[model samples]
Target: MKVAVDTEKCCGAGTCVMLAPDVFDQGEDDGIVVLLEEHPGEELHTTVREAANVCPAGAISLS
Candidate 1:
């Protein structure tokens, strides 16, 4: 799966990073969602999807 984060819509909630640290991170300055790994393995799909679901700003996308 591929993941994308819309920085403009991100609220720096860090949900993605918290849920899937291997696949997502936060900018030190802005705390926005940062895509750490684009095509994560299948094992990580669930966490990534959960992150997308919990994102308050709807900043994360999975494809």
Candidate 2:
């Protein structure tokens, strides 16, 4: 699975980070969504999808 995040659209809710720490993170300075893995493993697809779905700002995208 491939993941992407739009920092400009992020609201810093940290839902993505909570759901998929291996694939997402939050910048300490601005609290923006950080894409830790652009291409996560199959094992992480489900959680990644959940993170994307729950992103309040719609900053997360998957392909």
Candidate 3:
């Protein structure tokens, strides 16, 4: 699975980071979304999807 985050669309909600810290993080200064892993292991796919689902800004994308 592949994970991608559009920082420009991020609203600093932190939902993605809370759901999948292993694959996602937030910028300390702006609180924007950060992609920690562009391609996380399959084991993390579910959580990553959930994170994407819960993202209010629709900044997380999986392919």
Whole-model lDDT per candidate: 0.88, 0.90, 0.91
Candidate 2: C-alpha RMSD after superposition: 0.6
Question: Candidate 2 regions off by >4 Å?
Answer: none
As for candidate 3, its clashing pairs are none
lDDT of 3 at 49: 92
Q: RMSD to native for every prediction?
A: 0.7, 0.6, 0.6
In terms of lDDT, the best-performing candidate is 3
Better of 1 and 2 by lDDT: 2
- Supply the global lDDT for candidate 3: 0.91
lDDT of 3 by residue, 1-63 (tens): 887788889999999889889998889999999898999998999999999999999998889
lDDT of 2 by residue, 1-63 (tens): 778889999999999988999988899999998888999999999889999998999999998
For every model shown, what is its TM-score relative to the native structure? 0.94, 0.96, 0.96
TM-score of 3: 0.96
Backbone Cα, N, C clashes tallied per candidate = 0, 0, 0
